[model samples]
Target: MSARLRPLIAALALAAVASLTLGAAPAATAAPAPKPAGDDFPHPDLRLTYDATVRYRSEQAAIADGYQRTDECVEDPQLGGMGYHYVKPAHIGSTDPTRPAAILYEEDHKTGKRELVAVEWVVPNTGQSWPVLFGQPFDGPFDFEPVGPHYSLHAWIFKKNPSGVFSPYNPRVHCGPCPEGHAHP
Candidate 1:
């Protein structure tokens, strides 16, 4: 979901800071955010459990699992690129930032359905350290503010968000329907 910005440069800075770690993230092969074992929840904020496939799975599976496509897509390819919010049904209540009820995906323009890119937790409330929140040392910068009224945290687990691992908006991410000059990200 995109929102009004404080001009492009400043907005990009905020998104970047939110996703950045104190140091460069380790190589992708490191596998920092491993799925929980048995029934354990990954973070304190998360309210539900998920399978390993949820980490970097296909879009078809995510839709089958209940996520829905939305116009609230973000793009921040500047750093690397966080994708867009492919939100879940309205029935999915606001849950913890530890485990996202919804998912994030990158648009596959050629195919149209997009690809699973990342996941997040949009809580009605805010702030938990990066390490404690997602069982990793800052996947992305933590974002207290997002497009909607809620406090959201983005975790670019599957793909690296250029804004930062946790930056809510991806600078390079875009939506075809978003009217021009309206300012999103």
Candidate 2:
């Protein structure tokens, strides 16, 4: 074959191989589909808040993350318990869903075990608009003691709240029986 013809043939062969290689390449793998929000978590906000706060399911984890347990365990004789509050001073008056001002824990009277059940956002009322989260408004502009007039919202993500996920009190949660001298606050 003529040298020029040989060179032209080699170029055509290289081009064909390149084309075949490119055509045979596997398609890139697609990312897995995200889970759909279920009845347990009807909104993306709730899911995101859960994802951010679930790590604090243990009291120690919450403490390590800058939460300090309040001396009192809050409960209502008729409304049920709100559990022990572990507050993070820096997060006070925060509206950020991921940065809750308090972590709530329910104590097992029998086993003496503490389990984190909820997260709360609190902002003092200065006649400002009430803080809202997950499409629901904050629960107060009323006096809550020490803090005086404030608005608060709770998210019971770690544990199911029968009173409603955002309710201030959970019938299932308890500070357990108050100690001999320690009364339920």
Candidate 3:
């Protein structure tokens, strides 16, 4: 090749390569983003929900915000405990993750103190399909007396659950044996 022609040819090749790169469409099979760290939430909605509800760690704060303790302290010796469910009737059937219908509290047997452990979303089963949150389905269409048929999901955001974060029950939760003849206060 002639010396003068070599430079022009190299310039043409470079221009062709640049055009191919700049004009081509992006790859369709590009890899999805990496998963979040183990301690971090995979969903932004879940993280928002956690931030909104973590303030309920104070039982008084929860009560002041219209959360009322239900009649029973739910516990099952074999299956595990759901602790005391403090529910806000007005918030039921809410689809918003940041607005949970109930907050769960675990009681310390000896001290008679309560600690917030989880948040729950409840939707009345009006024959509709179960609501899904964070890609998980609500647990039931269970009929329980006054509540009738309902679907519920629990997220153990404040407490670690060996059963799983979304599991309905936690073995670590306890209803407790209240002092003397007094029931769990």
Looking at model 2, the pairs that clash are: none
Best by TM-score: 3
Summarize candidate 2's per-residue lDDT along 67-152 as a digit string, tens digits. 99776888887888888889898998988878889988888766887877788998999988767878889997879777788899
TM accuracy, model 2: 0.71
Q: Where is the poorest 10-residue window by lDDT in model 1? A: 123-132
Candidate 3: residue 147 Cα off by (Å): 1.4
Regions of model 1 farther than 4 Å from truth: 1-56, 75-83, 89-98, 125-132, 135-148, 176-185
Query: Which ranking of candidates, highest lDDT first?
Result: 3, 2, 1
RMSD for each of the candidates: 21.8, 12.4, 15.2
Query: What TM-score does prediction 1 earn?
Result: 0.46
Q: Higher TM-score: candidate 1 or 3?
A: 3
Cα TM-score of candidate 3: 0.71
Q: Rate the local accuracy (lDDT) of all candidates.
A: 0.52, 0.79, 0.81
Q: Ten residues in a row with the worst lDDT in model 3?
A: 33-42
The deviation in Å at residue 48 for candidate 3 is: 1.1
